[model samples]
Target chain A: MTTALTVETDPAQLCCEPSSQPVLNAVDAQESARVLKALSDPNRLRLLSIVKAGDGGEACVCDLTEPLDLGQPTVSHHLKILVDAGLLEREKRGTWAYYSLVPGALEAASARILGL
Target chain B: MTTALTVETDPAQLCCEPSSQPVLNAVDAQESARVLKALSDPNRLRLLSIVKAGDGGEACVCDLTEPLDLGQPTVSHHLKILVDAGLLEREKRGTWAYYSLVPGALEAASARILGL
Candidate 1:
């Protein structure tokens, strides 16, 4: 079952398996790649960093835009990308949107890439 | 110097500093993004995984191509990319080129992204 069909079609099926065992198939590679690509951007990475470095490990859009120096829309776009990628969780608090890193997103991605 | 010139012009300058303190600058975000982009590919991730899961935590090109189901040239191309990214080390032995994960490559990238 080392075909591309097994690898490209369903990523979640590839990595949702327990981590105690090593990933022995091509499917896992495809799935993990999707996650990595989502985190591969400079803006998205920075967004994650800001959120991770924020007080209580969370940040608002107002706080994030200042350090990024990008337009609010652009920062919002990047945050949306990270949120869509499942690496971040977004919540609207009144007029501002707050984002926080998903608890296990980084660790899960690390495990998938490192096979830990 | 929180301008784009400071962030985009040089990435190494952004993240080469120690990680004891939080990365509060835009430069750190930009440089760390470069490293993350380098590891974003499935082929590169798989290459790292195979090397990590190898007998001695290292693997040769001959061993990598089989698992990847990719041409030797493609695997070679990916290995070169990883090497260039400082995530892998290559040691040529006889007619074979062996690749191993550089120690701390993942950890550093993780620290950059997770701010840990």
Candidate 2:
């Protein structure tokens, strides 16, 4: 039952009883979609990938800018969006701000498509 | 080294060699972001959820609209987006169109945040 058949070639069958698995409610969908929307931008995902691939799973805006080939302000803007979506944590140290992936953020996003 | 510090309490430390893991490139990011963006709408995620939670892991627009309280056209629009994003496969039979989740689409997305 883990695999579902394509309805094109076969008749529709109910593999499980009706309402067996709970569905996502409107509120949950809204919250999850908000977080996902923040991550929809290519620049943002790249920034996230860089931070995740960084040593200690963290990176500063300055570190990302060189390889990102983007201005410091642009990188900071992306970081801000990620932080707002709770996907990244931001901290300032003297002069530079660093970013790290928030625990469970990615997993939560992944869980959605699995009907979580 | 999997857990990263908040940087508020500790000095930065590089836990691994530089550029140890491959990161997402611009092209990959763009492609991935497009899929995630399509999934970013609340109504769309809800529609996906109902389809995913279906007994055979598939659903027709008629099957979704009652619980969703959405008009048929509205539900169909959402489904079209999912299909276009390659998250769902659509097939027409007589009149109704049935949909099933595309394999590995969700995993590919989840893998991105993990720097895959």
Candidate 3:
């Protein structure tokens, strides 16, 4: 009876066999997740919005704190995360740091999610 | 010195004054982050891809585990997160549960990011 049951369990007969290969491979998934993780924070998203809406599509660290009611250090921390994630570019003009959206960064991120 | 410094500081002259309003308000940022957080996991992204490429754009929960070499419970947990984020829909057919991408859900998420 045990032998018969084992023989009857055909792999091809399984109902759950995968029908197609995933377009997003493991490596790409990890990279995509990293970008998404950086965007997972509320403050970070707000920072991106603030920067995007700023003069010339850029905003200074000093300018970010007031809108979010967050301390300079905290706001700077969030900006750094965005910079590291390749979503924002930081430029130092004089004594202040200005941040701008990396051109096409958001579009690329959106593509990653959709393409996956 | 205090009085002199105070007189020298002009709000309009500040380098950090925001030039425009953020398109993403705090409340909306929070909501967008929730969806992003759900997609931030590597496993979850892979799961989404698999479901997306599955037969008829759907796949059984049983078929999911083998691809990632993860157990059923873990896969199910990830799937639940996607469903709660409104990115995926789940249906039960007989003894198996199948998952598929929610229509326009990815596009909406992408829009949220780009619009911000």
Candidate 4:
């Protein structure tokens, strides 16, 4: 199944306004925090790194399993979390599922924090 | 007492490399995830937004309590978490503690996710 998602502005820049000013509000904080929680795990982080470093900026399930030294199910689980958090996108081709990073998810998230 | 902390790069850009490229590693995932875990909270995110939007890019304990509708101790607790996560810097100005956003922390995190 192909899930369509919206790519927001770079999170790094999106998180806050210029350094001299303040723009973050209560709602912004809660939303940003939820994004952070998604990346807070060692395995998930590793999985993301693997995916980002993969050829064509994407990795398939079978290719990811060995590098993570994790069970296929565990790797699959982490990929699901990344996908749910909007950090990664999944595309199934034939029997394999290929995962790629969401273009602006990270940037928008980081921008909120950096105010850059 | 004053605590000195190092502000890393914007999390957004720091998380990953340019698209069509992969640079994330095992270590990067673990480190970035830890950072994400720090931002994955509703209260903490709100607190961060409040701080970022404050004057002079900083806010004091007394100023934060009312906006959050949280007890002083709870606000203090959340601030501590942000500070611990390196998302903020705490400065003791007289009897009050002032909090400010850590430059680049958010960008680095977001970049990691966006691979920007």
Candidate 5:
């Protein structure tokens, strides 16, 4: 014969289990944060906007300076950061450099957060 | 009689027009950057992932610390930042605190980037 009793339970099991579902690993989190950190600036965002709206789907560095009221050097610095983050591509066209959004980068960024 | 001129254009007009389609305004950019800044930390991103995957869409503060290998105070600080950024909501049950993702905030954050 067997008897069952339910007067109490183990104290440890009362605590909720941490979800087994995949969470962001440290390496991926670091990488995603780096990209996001690059985008967490107002000027950088404005630069992306200007480049995105530029004629022929690209904008010369000269055109970017005037709109943001930033110096050419300052705008260039911001653009370089965006370029490094893989969100923008830079091209040299004779005397001036042009910048344009990397195709699908914005969508990829959006997906990063949603997929997380 | 009027003569049509096509040989050259005015010097100012040669530069592309800054986007007439309205880029992110300063206020909105500042606001969005704050939220993204909150997310730009590796620990914070992991915190969000764990909470999102927690049972019944909620998790206790006690459960969060071990998975991230962070101290309770450190985890609390990160949770506070996420809460302040409008990404998570906190509720108190007895002596412990519970956190859940703020509905639609991730979508809104993604929208902020795409809309920009």
Candidate 6:
């Protein structure tokens, strides 16, 4: 899916005025809100950071449980949410699941907040 | 208050490896989650866009109600949440409440997602 929120905008200029390019419309706003909502939890953000910090920019499900003081099931649930939200990608390896940050996912979300 | 999430990072490189810089800790994750949860609503984003698109990058509560297809109270509630999140600033002028984007608020949030 094409992420409209990924549009580039200057960090120095945060607000997008009406006189400027098109503002975030209702449809785009709703879609953006959904992904933003996915990122609204502390455990989830922690999980994302852990997975992001793993070796080779990827981590096994087994390695993620210790850092956040969460169990495997709870951690897996958070990982599932992040995966469904398009922020992460998951791969099945034997009995373990490997997770990685989807390239440009965080940047796209960042762009949406900075862009209109 | 200083915003740790506002630390700059290259957008092209989104992941934060364990061997590299510090990843988002639990405390920062919670703080970031609070602000992110604030941006998780559709109407709120629409309201933000309306305010952001207004003249001088600000808008009045009266002007905001109609375009958003919501009554004054509803719109105000959404505005309050955004304000609490430090995304919008409110000013009292006469009988109306004027709102404007807090400069770099969005960037701080955007920076957080990109940074860690």
Best candidate, lDDT: 3
Clashing pairs in 6: none
Please state the error at residue B35 of candidate 2 in Å.
1.1
Off by over 4 Å in 4: A1-23, B1-23, B114-116
Candidate 5: docking tier:
acceptable
CAPRI-style class, candidate 4: incorrect
Ranking by lDDT: 3, 5, 6, 2, 1, 4
TM-score of chain A of each: 0.74, 0.76, 0.86, 0.73, 0.82, 0.77
Candidates 4 and 5 compared by DockQ, better number = 5
Candidate 1 is scored at a TM of: 0.72
C-alpha DockQ for predicted model 5: 0.39
How does residue B15 of candidate 5 score in lDDT? 55
**iRMSD per model?**
10.2, 5.4, 2.3, 9.6, 2.5, 7.5
Residue A111 CA displacement from its true place in model 4, Å: 3.0
The candidates' DockQ values read 0.18, 0.26, 0.62, 0.21, 0.39, 0.25
Assess every candidate by TM-score: 0.72, 0.77, 0.90, 0.71, 0.84, 0.80
lDDT of 2 at A98: 73
Q: Give the Å shift of residue B10 in candidate 4.
A: 44
Per residue, candidate 1 scores C-alpha lDDT tens digits across A1-116 of 66977778653343322222224455766677777778777677766776887777788777766566678799888888888778999998666677898998988876654452
Superposition-based RMSD of candidate 5 using all C-alpha atoms, in angstroms: 7.6
Which pairs of residues collide in model 5?
Answer: none
lDDT of 4 by residue, A6-85 (tens): 23543333333323322456566667666777778877776776776777978776667666577878888888888888
Q: What is the DockQ of candidate 6?
A: 0.25
Error of 3 at A57 (Å): 1.1
Q: After best superposition, candidate 2 residue A60: deviation in angstroms?
A: 1.5
What's the residue-level lDDT of A96 in candidate 6?
A: 65
lDDT for each residue of candidate 3 in A51-101, tens digit (9 for 90 to 100): 888879988877788778888889888888999999999999887888999
Across A40-107, the per-residue lDDT of candidate 2 in tens digits comes to 99888888888887768788665777666778789888889999999999888766677898988887
lDDT of 5 at B87: 98
Which has the better lDDT: candidate 3, or candidate 5? 3
- Tens digit per residue, CA lDDT, model 4, B27-46: 76667776777778877777
